[model samples]
Target: MKILVGIDTGVNTGFAVAVDEGKGGDLIQVISLTITQAMARVIELCELYSKSQVYLYIEDPRKRTWFTGGREKAQGVGSVKRDAQIWENWCKENKIKYTLVHPKDNCTKYKSDTFKKVTGWMGRTNEHARDAAMLVHRRSVRA
Candidate 1:
């Protein structure tokens, strides 16, 4: 069996794990972490799943359009970008094979209403965690 690890990189990082079952994937766990803790957590998971090949899928932070009236949003976006660069560098250094999953490619269900409809109004523990799970779910054979 192989494990698929999905990540949502943002202010509050999200990570989820799923391993392939004979029929599809088995959703396992989800957690939220700080930017500083993200890389270490992934490495920990990789070590834990040593018997299974691990593939990571991280959501590429889409370009956020900042209001022309305020620079705050721009600064926030800058921070997110820096964090992403750190993740990329860590992955390269560790030789971890990974994929970047774009927001659009997953589906148009990110919005609350759309997500509610698709998930039967299921409330998630954390939005970032939900995003990570959804990303992993997208690559599931049953998806």
Candidate 2:
């Protein structure tokens, strides 16, 4: 068995999981939740899929940027780096293998563009979740 996990982190983080059950790529599950909730979900997934070899595809946080009051925001308001660090620590503690994937590797030239396309398709709600799921789909097909 093989399992792939994709994650999009920010103010609204999203996570998607795909499984290869000897039948090619199949979307096993998807979720849009808070960063804290997403972390919990990841832990749950690790346990649920422990029997299989898992590979994580996480959107690199360094590429994300945000603005506030007409100027770039430096802290708070969902820091991708912070989120990534948390996830990284969790992965280390749990012995989960993870890979950092840039948004361009998946699609969407820019972070904002990625967010727009994802949110636009998902109706501006749960965009991160939808994007995360789409990333999984994209990678699975490519594989």
Candidate 3:
């Protein structure tokens, strides 16, 4: 079994997890919540799926968010970076093979836009979870 995780952050953070069950990847879970909860959930997932290969796909943390006719907002970028760093360290310590995939690499568009499209009405809410599932599906096909 293999798993892919996707994350998108804005007004709210969205997380999606996908699991590969031989044939392909399927959406196993979806969540949109505060950064703290997101991190906690990631940890939980890691433990739950300890036997599976876990890959995390997150939007580039370095990208700046420029508002229309206004200055850029760096509000959540720091938190994203911090969360990523924590996850990275955890993976290393636990010997979990993980990969950080840029959103543009998968969607061929801006991370925000790609996230919006993938999430639809749900918007940023729980979108990451859906995105994670999609990433897993794609990975499974490629594998």
Tell me, by TM-score, which candidate is best: 1
The regions of model 3 sitting more than 4 angstroms off are 9-11, 63-72, 76-79, 108-133, 141-143
Candidate 2: stretches off by over 4 Å: 22-24, 63-78, 108-125, 138-143
Order the candidates by lDDT, highest first.
Answer: 1, 2, 3
Positional deviation of residue 73's Cα in model 1 after best superposition, in angstroms: 2.0
Model 1 ranges with Cα > 4 A deviation: 62-70, 108-124, 138-143
TM-score of 1: 0.75
Which tens-of-lDDT digit does each residue in 49-70 have in candidate 2?
7723676777876664534553
Per-residue lDDT over 39-124 for candidate 1, one digit per residue giving the tens place of the 0 to 100 score: 77777877987623677777765544433545886776676677667777777888886777666665533666665565443555
Model 3, TM vs. native: 0.60
Tell me the tens digit of each residue's lDDT in model 3 across 69-92.
Answer: 322334455666666666567667
Backbone clash count for every predicted candidate, in the order shown: 0, 0, 7
lDDT of each: 0.68, 0.66, 0.57
Q: For model 3, which pairs clash?
A: 6-132, 14-128, 15-128, 15-129, 16-128, 16-129, 16-130
Question: For this target, which candidate reaches the highest lDDT against the unseen true structure?
Answer: 1
